[model samples]
Structure formats: structure tokens, C-alpha cells
Target: MKRHSIQTYRRIIQITVAITFIILPLLNQLGFTFIWGNFLNIHIGDLTLSDPLAVLQVTLKNQYFSPRLLMSAGIILIIAMCFGTIFCSWICPFGLLSELVHGLAKRVLPNTFKKLNFQISGFKIKIYILSLGLIFFFLFCTRPIINQLSMPLWYSQIFQYLFIQKHISFAVLFVAVILFAEFISRNRLWCRYICPQSFLLVIAKLLNPFHLKVGYRKEKCIGNKNNNPCQKACSLSLDPRTLNNLLETECNNCGDCIVACKKLGKALNFQFSRHFS
Candidate 1:
């Protein structure tokens, strides 16, 4: 990942962003809207996206949630927990946007955002709210429905907004979800702090070897050499110089370390390895 070519991964992300957010909407503008998402009963990966528990917990109108859908959700969850969030960087729009935001935040915030603290209790607030809210609402409200003020479905329903055309209420969730995760948390407060979709990714990152890790050559990391590139490169405020715990789980595999190491001559490098290690 160091001293190589342009990251085709980011290119793939840019292309997907265009096709999904741009092309799909443009197609809908021409009255090209179809129930393509519904014409099928179920597909293999559809479950992962539909996320039965996700849809069930929310106010969204379900178009698909077959048994296969449930199975895919389960399997992907198992995989993500063991493999870190390949989905976060590769598949999730929020994740990709967050990565972009990480770069932008560094440039813009300079002092404020970089110095922010990611306290454990601060991180736990999302899940605490989600769990307690789900129980309280289910018990009181007659509809045993799911609450989704912050889910991926909320976002997809956003893109589907330009297409749905008629009842655009679902778009409200889209807007609110985006405004909170995108504008507010900076990057991945939902995924890192609130998302159940993140449940497995957190486990996976905790156990996966391929997670973004800091290779700190202990002696050199101390600043008599007067160098601190790894600390500077971290977008997550995770200083590679101080990182001994791989179980931080919040590590998104963006190569801030690789970027940081260019000045340090490979003192800090990130490579694929077992999180179980």
C-alpha cells in the first residue's frame, strides 16, 4: 500500500458515487422510474441491503424482505465483524463520504476538529439511545415497528426520493440522517457510534488482520529524531505512535499512516494483518 500507484479503490468509489447519486436520479427525471426494486421477490444480496431488522425497526414501507434477505443479512454481518469494514470504505456511501470528509476536515478545521476527543462514553451514546428507544417505543406504541432515525435505509430512501416522486415523506428521514451524520458528526458518528450495521464491522475490525494498523518501531517513534508523522497522518486522531491496542475497532482503513509515512521514510506503514493478532 506504500510507494505504489494511485488508489484504484478511491476511483471505484468515485465512479459508484456518480452512478448511484447522479445517474440513477437523472434516469428517474426522464420518467424512467420502474418498480425494478420490487419486480423481484428476493435476490441473494438483497437481504443484506434490505436488512429485515433494519426495515422492521423503522417506519419505512417494505418492498422486499424475503428469507434469503434475512440470510444474507446474517452472513454479511458475520463476515463484516471478522473482516473489519470493507463495506465501510468500499460499499457504504456514508463511509466513503466520511473518508472524503476526513481529508476536508483536516484542511478546514486545522485546530478544532483534529483536537477533538473520541471518548468511549461519547461513542456509546448512539447505541444506548437506539437500544432504549427501541424498547420504549415498542412497548408503548401499538405498532411493533422499528425506529430508524439513523440507518442506511434512511439514506437509500433518500436517493429513491428523486424517483418515488409522489409520497416524498421518506425523503425526510434521508435528509435528517444525512444532516446528522454528514453535517454534524463530521464522519461516521452514525457508523462508529450509532449504526447496528456497524455491529459486525466493529467486531470484524477488532478481529480482522487487514484493519488499518500502525507499525511503530518503538525506539524511533519517540521524538529525538524529532518526527511525528504517524500522529499527524491519522485522520481519526489515533496516533500510531501511541497505538498499542489494535482492538480500537473504529479504525477505518484509510491510509493516513501511509500518507504520513512518506516524510518519515517508512517509519510508520500500514499493511494487511490479522486483527486477532
Candidate 2:
């Protein structure tokens, strides 16, 4: 398949999943009670799928575990282990919003200013935040304070409240502020720097060395040595050329870089193997 075709398919899936969250909540308001709850906790008939991290927090605090919660969390963790947090690329509503705003910023901003690099890496910051949150949870019996920073959960909750409860949440304001910052800064500040939710998934993916990932063919790259198109196309500012390590922890396998490389060198492709180099 053409590289753009692969990316277009991913975009369609991303848009569909984002819309599903919005429509499902409205369905409940219209008396169709087939599904309910936000991303933190979702129920469909007898089956449930929930945030594994949220489940972990509750289990730790109460010193109790429900079969249903464990099952739901297991399903999500299994998916992450196999596909390396594909949820961030293909299912997150907030990721869609961030990508849209970032794309527009890319077009308007000069090339030299488009990619911003903070001295502190976003991935390390998220790990630090996750460590502290878990420490607080154990010491203070905190009520999953990390959940409060979840933009996608907030995105889904906004719709659930608006449709199911006839109420508006202040969480919408948080999303708006984050999006505005992303637009001006031309960086996915929230997803890269502060989202503690994806931290667990990243660890799971790292443990699974054979997870699907974007691969790079260094021999075929014909682009200018100084300027890499694949790197430029990355929404999260990841260097796709570094296939040896593949930056598995932070990359969501979004395929934007693959599409960008296809036109110039056809060096990047998605593969389902542990051999990255």
C-alpha cells in the first residue's frame, strides 16, 4: 500500500474513535442505555473496559480488587503490550485535537520555529510525575489525583456531563487552555510532558520487545543528511531515523513520519517485529 494510504486509514480510525466517545454519551441521554461511563470506567452490557491506572489506584487505596475491574484493566494492558499505546494515536480524542492545532501551527510558523525543544525531556517529566503521584497515593490516600490531569478523560466527561447530566464541567476549560498552549508553542505539551496515564502503557510496551512499531531503513534514505523530513513530520517531535532504539517509550506509531518519508526516500514503514535496525 502507498504510505499515504496507511496514514489516511489511521486518520480515519482516530476520527471515528474520537466521535464514538461523543456519540455514546448522547445515546444514553436519548434512552439508549447500551453503554455508559467515561474513559476512566466504561461498561457495555456485561463487558467492561477501563483505565488500568485508575483501577490500580482504587485497588491500592481500598486494598480490594473486583473481578470486573481487573478484567477491564487487563484487556487494556494487553492491547498496550501488543501495540505500544496505539490508543494515543488512534483512539484519543484529545490527541486528535492536539494534532489538528499543531498541524495548523506548523503551516503558519516558520520552519526554524516550528519544532521547539525544551532542555528537559517530556518523557522523563511524565515518569517523574507518575512516581510522585503513586507515592502520594500510598502515603496520603489520594483519590487518583493523576486522573484530574487526564485530558482525554476530561474530553469524554465533558460530553457525558453535557448529554447525560445536563451540566457543564470546568474540565472543558482545562482542555481549551492546553490546546491554546499547544497551538502557540507548536508542541504537544500535555501528551509529551504531563500525561501520567500513558506512563504505564509505555512501560508495558517496553517490556514487550516484539510490539509493532515504525521501522526505519537507513540504506534507502535519500533525503538531505542535514534535514530529515520524517523528523519534521512527527507531531510529537520524535526522531524517526533513530530506529536502533526506535524511541519506543514515547512514540505512538502515528505514521505521520512514514508518510513524510515515503515521498522523499521511502525509508520508514510500520513493522510487527522486534528487529528495528
Candidate 3:
């Protein structure tokens, strides 16, 4: 029997997370208090998990430390340090939606619009946006303003508002609009450029030199240099062959490229090393 690809497993996990969140809110409404809260801060029995960026905003605004919140956020950051941004690839509901939308765009959109180039780096744009958001929050906001930018949080809260409060949130429209724009542009714009939530995860991943990343072996590669299947397989439009260079920071270790290369030359694989080489 043929083995399932990495993307198949990733899609399974992503769908499970998405469906689980939808169910969690319903369970909470029915007095199933074992797992509670949205993606910004969630509790599974005694264990807590939180978005690091949300925790940072709250910590900065309150000017006081909550050990529980700190530990919760630290756990996420530690995972990012060890495994890169797997949350983005494997668990985020928004990510799953974006990937599906992107895939549809690729299939239906014109070839001319498939590869649009941006003048500035997507990661740099994210950093700039993050800086401005923090500045704005520090200057005038009383609440954790950055938390509003989290798509995952909004995704979870959509179910929370529907099941618990019986309220229809406009956040569903907000997410739809973003997905529509991405489909039109044939780019995963929110994930690649606009997400402030991923900035902290990227930073955490950078801090750990030996974090999990796609390792490339040029010698093992037998495919056409001009037209590589690995590059075509990447949903983020990243080149797996050049992952050792500056482009490494943008990679979320989704392993789509590795799966694509498996039959061609088996040139790409996941590894934990100080450098991709």
C-alpha cells in the first residue's frame, strides 16, 4: 500500500483542530468545563495554552506578571523554538482555510497571476506591522489590542460567540473578506505578510539555531533546476533548494516540498541542525 503524504497527515491534524474548537464551545455551553477558553488563552484541565503575542500585549499593558499566563505563553514559544512554526502549518484553523483557498486559487486562477512578486519581504512587513501595533497599544490602548489581529483567536471566538452567547459575530465576515482577497491575488497574504501573531513565533524559531527545518541536498537532486517540482509543491511559493539561504526564516517546515521531492530525487527532508547544509 502507498503511504500517505505529509500534507495528508497535516490536513488531518488541521481539520481535527478546527472541528475540535467548534465542538469545545458547544461542550462548554453544556457544562463540559474540562476544556475552556478561546485560542488566545485555552485551558485543558490543569494545563493552559496561550498565544505568545497575546500574552505579550497583556503583560505590556498591565505592567504586572501573571505566572500562569507567562508559563502558558512560554510553552508555545518553547515549541516554536524547537520545531519552527508548526502551529501555523499543522494546527491553525485559519491556516487550513488559507491553504485550501490557496490551493483552489492555484487550480482556477490564470497562470499569469499565479506568481505575483512583492517589492518588499513579507517577513519584514510583518515586523513593521508588529512594531506599529505595539506602539499604538502602548500609547493609547487600554486592552490588549494586538489580540484582535489574531486569526486563530477570531476563529475560535466565532464558535464561542455562536454557541455560548447566541450572537453572530462579524468576525466570520472579516475572515471571509481576507480569504477572498487572498483568492483573488493568488497569495496567502495574511499568513505570509500581514499576521502579527506569527511574529513572535518566527522570533522564537530564529532564537534556536538547531530548530527543525528542511534540509536540502543538491547532490541528491536530479530534477530540472529551471523547473523544480519541489518549488511547485510549496504553497508559500518558497524554493526548497534555497532554504539554506536567507529564505529559511520564512519557512514553516510544512514538508510539502519534501513530499514532492520524495519520488523525484528524495533531495529534501526535515532535519534539526545549526544550518541547512
Candidate 4:
């Protein structure tokens, strides 16, 4: 399928998941017992799908482990290994909002909203944040505290609360604050840097050298400085022209660059291969 079609599929998946979470809690409150719990700990029928980072934190510090949690996390990791952190693009509810916020900022205030390109990579900073979070969890027993930082989880929790308790949560404020910060930064600051939950999925994706990823054919590219649509289309500010191992780890394979290049040079397209091999 074309890159645009693939992106449309992703958006449909994202929106469906977001709406499902909102409805599940409401159904449960209305005497339906099929699904329960928020994004941190989801229970659908007899199966459970909990956040891996949250499970890891509790397991390490409290010495708690459940077969259901491991199974759920393992399933997610396996998917990530094959698809390269697609959860960030096609599943995570907050990603939709973040993308929208960034897109709006760029259109409304193009010059002022242009992000400050940092010399440092987001992966390095994300690793540091993950390490610090684990350390704090192990030392201070601050396990649930880290959950507050999860924007997607917060989105789910907000709906869960609104449905279960029939009230709004202050977590909506946290979502608002993060969206505002991302709007100002004009980048995916949280997903790229601060979101510890994504770190494990990224690591899982790195394990599979051959996976679905955006492939750049530099020779095919009709290099043009003024009409660099691929770069502009990239939400994470990654240069899709450089097809390498590093790009595999950083990119969520959203296919925006590929779509951007479609009418231009057709230089970028989705390919499954071991580029290093």
C-alpha cells in the first residue's frame, strides 16, 4: 500500500484505541465486567495488559511478578521488535494529540514555533531518565509516582475516572501542560526524551535488525534545498534521507517522510531489511 494509506491506517488504529479506552471504563461502571483498569493496568476478560515500565518498576522494587503482566509486556515487546515501536505512532493516544499540537504550532507560528535543534540525541537523554526513574523506584519506593509522567496513561486514566466516578480529573491538567510544552518546544520532547515507557520498546526494536522501517535511497533522491518536504514532514525532526542503523532506533516509522517524498523524488519508502547486513 502507499505511504499515505499506511498513515491513514495508523490514524484509524490510534483513534479507535483512544475511544475504546474511554468506552471500556464506562461499560465496566455500567455493570459490564468484561474490561477494567486504566492504561497502567488493563484487564480485558481474563487477560491482562499492563505497562512494561510500570510492571518492571514494581517487580524490581517490590519483588512482585505476575504471569499475566509478563505475557502482556512480552506480547507488546514482540510486536515492537517486528514493527519498530509502532505503538508510539499507531497505538499511543497521547501521540495523536502531540502530533496535532505540533502541526498546529507550525502552521500558526512557523518561525516562532521552529524548534531549537539540540546537539544531543533524544535516545541518550531518554536512557538517563529511565535509569534515574528505576533508581528512584528502587531506593525510595516511589513506584506509582512515575506513572504520573505518562501522558498516554494519563489520557486513559482521565477517561477511566470520568466514566467510573462521573467526574473530571486533575490529570487533564497534566496532559494540557505537556501538550503546551510540546507546542512551545515544537518537538516530541516527551516521547523522544522523557518517556521511560518507550525506552524498552525502542530496545526491543533494536534487537531486530530486519524490520519494517523507512528506507531512503540517496541516489534516487533529487536533492533540493528549498523543497525539502521529507524533513519538514518529519514530526520528530529526523532526517529520513539518512538510512542507517541509528535512524532505525530513533524513528517510529510513521511514514510521513515517505508520503512527503511521494510527489517529489520518491526517495523514501517503507522497506523491511537488515540495512546493516
Best by TM-score: 3
Candidates' C-alpha lDDT: 0.51, 0.84, 0.88, 0.80
lDDT value for model 1:
0.51
Better of 1 and 4 by lDDT: 4
Clash pairs (backbone) in predicted model 2: none
Q: What is the lDDT, from 0 to 100, of the residue 4 in candidate 4?
A: 46
lDDT of 3 by residue, 23-118 (tens): 998888789999998888899999999889988988878988999899999999999999999999999999999999999998998887745646
| Better candidate number, 2 or 4, judged by TM-score | 2
Candidate 4: segments with Cα more than 4 A from true spot: 1-4, 63-65, 110-113, 142-144, 244-246
Candidate 2 ranges beyond 4 A from true positions: 1-4, 110-115, 244-246
To one decimal, what is the Cα RMSD in angstroms of model 2 from the true structure?
2.2
Model 4 misses residue 90 by how many Å?
Answer: 0.3
Q: Itemize residue pairs with steric clashes in candidate 4.
A: none
Tell me the tens digit of each residue's lDDT in model 1 across 1-277.
5554224665487457535643455555675554123201113232323443453443323434556556645565555645445555556665655556656655676465433356563235645765776686666654323435434445455555556554465656554555445444454455556655554456545665555554555554434335666655554556555554432555555555655665555555555464322
Q: Candidate 2 on 138-160: residue-level lDDT in tens?
A: 88865876687777899998988
The positional error of residue 262 in candidate 3, measured at the CA in angstroms, is 0.3
